[model samples]
Target: MSAHRMSDPLDRRRFLTAAALRGATVVGTGVIGATALGAVDADAVFAAPLRRPLDPAVPAGAFVEGRITSIDGGVLEVAGSHGDYARVRVTGATSVWKVRPTTAASIETGDGLYARGVPMPDGTVAADAVWVNIVNLHTTIRGIEKTRLHLAHGSHEIVGNLLPATSSASYSGAAPTADLSGLRIGQGAQVLGAWRPSDDSVDIVRVAVGPGAGHRR
Candidate 1:
């Protein structure tokens, strides 16, 4: 069976149930961050706020953000962060990454998402890429060890794990290097990583140190 079809049916069902409940609550309560976009302009919407502009060769599309409301087959229904609703069509060509290359089966309801895709005439988005539950956090290092860094993000404590062969650190915003020995306790850092669905832990993709640590794209 294809990996996409490998998600446990029971898990999907449970996720769908929870998603429905959450969607209703979100709608009724009128959450603070939810806003509706009457019309979407993909290129303008998906552009990363802090990152460098994407290549001009890329086609324009709507950028959608919010919690997953439902997933039926390959269509993902999302309640936009600003109160808009969007249907994102995911195909085999779509690149799904969350700190690393991943499959569509890994997606679950209630998870946050950022998707970039061409907007269809029908108002749906033909997604070319999706980043699920990715977080860029600016925090201070509370403690450090050989393989993990204890961080303070507001009032919450975050545990960041350095993934061997994949994790690296950057001084300023220069090229990333594998050496993390320069990282120190009580230092300010910015972490770009994927949040674990089960806990406050994050699997680090890259760590930035120094005054401009967390501001880089």
Candidate 2:
């Protein structure tokens, strides 16, 4: 999930307290992993989806899908399926959440998201955001590493250890690779994914990061 009132620490705390009363858990315990720090300019990877109206009568209103390119404070930088950027505002009323059954628990970069709300003056959509739309894509593993792994579609740079049961399970038609040696650093990969915000790391079900991973989903 996300801390919506991210602009001010004090405001975040107060807002979170209110959210807790509303039955939303606001602890920075689990859900978000990574710092949202690194530059994500990899625009060539995603393919644009065909546009179908959410409701023809609604004209300017429809659901758009995209990969989360970056998150700075309360701002969510989403590069759309068509390679367009949708800068969304994560306000106190905004929700931070996830999709289910992808993993035990893990959140990482590259998750899919959908937001709903009004568009703002700066070209950013003001999300009356729903956090549950975020999805953890599942893929098979083709490589491994000491810290990071070469997944099947995108790189899963893990920040912690992988369990034997989790690592050994077959996903996307392949079992987990045992050794980390000889894996390329910049190749793309895919894997069964999960997000555990408490640990600040994502768990991989499988990975396919390598030279042959250009197959798009």
Candidate 3:
């Protein structure tokens, strides 16, 4: 067999480094601070330390924040909430999270996403990390059941599904734990998790109650 040509178009090494760097999130820190991508050096931005403080900056450039409209192999067509569109290319090195750390195969059309990566010459974003159906909401627990929690966010009520093995809690600035005993009804909390499109419910990653709830980082 002939020797393979060393002319692969994509630089996998650099992309790997970016993925490794961006994957760092402090334990129990669910919120992400996305700064403007235009002025940032693409090489360093992915390696940049994610600040703990919460800032709602929408990462521009090759970053896509929206719902997946279509999937063609590893390519995802996304429709942004704001009248924008993006095409994201997922690869083996891409880190995916849907409720938990998962793989690209778990992504489906209609799943909401936030993908950040470098832009190829063809205008497709080569994703480093993709978070599917992820939502971080600040709500007050109105009611609690064995498997679900009724939450009130402003005037909208939401049903938060609790997974016995997956759902967790962080109480009063403590680290995350599987215990739900401390959660009190009517307590203000932050729910971070994946949204279930079929039922409009959330499979919670964890419910945070304490001095560190909400967008307090």
Full-model lDDT for every candidate:
0.67, 0.43, 0.71
Candidate 1 at 10: error in angstroms?
Answer: 40
Off by over 4 Å in 1: 1-60, 211-217
lDDT of 3 at 35: 21
| Stretches > 4 Å off in candidate 3 | 1-13, 16-61, 211-217
Higher-scoring candidate on TM-score, 1 or 3: 3
lDDT of 3 by residue, 173-208 (tens): 789999998899989999999999988999989999
Q: After aligning candidate 1 to the native by TM-score, how far in Å is the CA of 110 from where it should be?
A: 3.0
lDDT string, candidate 2, 23-138, tens digits: 33322333321112322121210121212233333223324467667765555677888878786555443444453322113323465667664444456664433343333453
What value does the lDDT take at residue 189 in candidate 1? 91
Clashing pairs in 3: none
Clashes per model (N, Cα, C within 3 A): 7, 33, 0
lDDT of 1 at 10: 25
TM for every model, in the order presented, reads: 0.65, 0.33, 0.72
Candidate order by decreasing TM-score: 3, 1, 2
The alpha-carbon lDDT assigned to residue 29 of candidate 1 equals 29
Q: Is candidate 2 or candidate 3 better by TM-score?
A: 3
Q: How many clashing residue pairs, candidate 1?
A: 7
Lowest summed-lDDT stretch of 10 residues in model 2?
40-49
Task: Let me know the TM-score candidate 1 reaches against the reference structure.
Answer: 0.65
